[model samples]
Target: MLQSFKCEACKSNNQPSVSNHKDNSHLPDCKDEISLNTIGVIKTMFLEKRAVPRQASEAARIISRIELNSRIFNNPEHSLEGLETFSHIWILYYFHRNQIHLKSKVAPPRLGGERVGVFSTRSPHRPCPIGLSLVQLDRIDNGTIYFYGTDMVDGTPVLDIKPYIPQYDVPRKIERQEFFSPREAPDGEENCESVKTASTSTSGNLVSNVTVPNWVTNCKYLSVTFNETAEQQLQELAVEKKSITEILRADPRSVYLRTKYGSQIYTFQLGENTVTCKFDDQNSIVNVLQVRKVVILGDIPVSDDE
Candidate 1:
């Protein structure tokens, strides 16, 4: 035998009541009861926190504080004792900023900057609003835990914490999919020679195979180009690309400067290697000219004179 229930929030008429038996007289209809205080709140020193990274792995040096409630602090020290050995720790917390219910689809910055399903992408808007992050554990003291490289905002409530075990988590071999590919360089000189020979036999033009830099590999945006000239222009603008990249990578509105183009303040969107600006005036159009004397961080083309 089963019981039928009606929700108080939606009213009895809106929701359907089902019982093991078809007879309505056998089961009485009632509303479902739920408890809201399942999780505890966390306190931190960062109150007016801004420009926080969207992912914890990106910001691996910035320090932040975390405080757990005293009621559930039993064996907290024992739980965190083995965490010092691991390089990274997984933080499971709630997204206090999200106000809407979880949707089936979400707009992800990756996936060619398109909307993906909630299950596929890590969006803040969800039924639980729970956020998970792999952050570096710097130190742990009493009820307060200090972490580095966190995307969580100040005063965010923490649900749980777990040490990241590379042996158990890392797969022995991963099959590449169309959306994601392995970043490691190819092995063996013989294999490389064979590839070069095949390429030479097909076309005379020697195609130089180069590995992509770490900075470019980690970039989320596809439109940006990290050439020398582009970097030089960014440097001339009195902005550091590393720092600017951090700001632009996350929510741009949080990091972008409010500048007066004409009369109104317009926010600029930055790419991995390019900085884009918009004018408030309707008549003005954005354009980019040739760049000169760009700072080259990695392997770049050189002239005969140099």
Candidate 2:
């Protein structure tokens, strides 16, 4: 059971004190318990946590499926009335595999391990441990939805689904801006404007102008290359090389691994095969070492006679 409380400071008109906020005694005891149920489960290529992309958009080439629970719906087919019209959908799912504690600040991989407010980055370690992803809708059959761009594990529980409407989702007043990254800044120069496009809103409740540090905008992606052995193996397995290239180019390694381990051998399960690769950090290249089929040790083979 999830428990929550109401704070008295929220009831007051004046701004609440931040210094003695936790030690205050005027707060009343109004405990509220909330419960949520899963509407469906998502099926993806990622079987483990090692190589799942940090964001669904990073894995745009990957396809996934969502199977709604039949027990929860009287008419599963009727429940999904007109979701196919939209090209994309939003998935709200629980971070069931997250074991880390809540953090006020986190270091995103793209930031090169620079610490920032947890809210600024899309880290899984949150107060609620709930995840949100926007994926392209391919098709729908009955209560099942086939989508592209999934970052979740194979059996992630989906809480809810919503169609993506551009008018409601996208903001107005988008333009290009220049900002120099900290690493690339010239000597004796504290700040410099570089390049990128952003949106600003003057009328609505949104911030007048959106601003971000140079590191956020100056992200560099690693180039992926397959060797002769890996290329032959991929052909033998009949795996699409483009899919593997897309996943590797995003550099799925966590900040901890990238910072501590540096260039090392990384292995991840891709479909029914295990992919092994070596990271060349200096050149920002990922060389595919080999691809092999995953073997399950315990299962006995069934024959036609049985």
Each prediction's Cα lDDT score?
0.51, 0.79
Candidate 1 residue 127 Cα shift, in angstroms, is 1.9
* Top candidate by TM-score: 2
After superposition, which runs of candidate 1 have C-alpha atoms over 4 Å from their true positions?
1-50, 74-78, 111-113, 174-245, 249-306
Cα lDDT tens digits for candidate 1, 1-306:
236544453244554545444786644445345334323454432232344556776555556766666667575565566556656777788778778575788654433335666776566778778889887777888656787775666678877777764433432332246238434344321244544454455343222433433433565431222456556676666544454444333433321232222423222322122244332224333222212332334665322223
Query: Which RMSD values do the candidates have, in order?
Result: 15.9, 11.8
Candidate 2 lDDT over 157-267, as tens digits, reads 999999875434654443353243135435333221221121122235344455677777787788999999999988998988988888888898888998899899998
Candidate 2's C-alpha lDDT?
A: 0.79
- lDDT for 232 in candidate 1 is 65
TM-scores, one per candidate: 0.49, 0.76
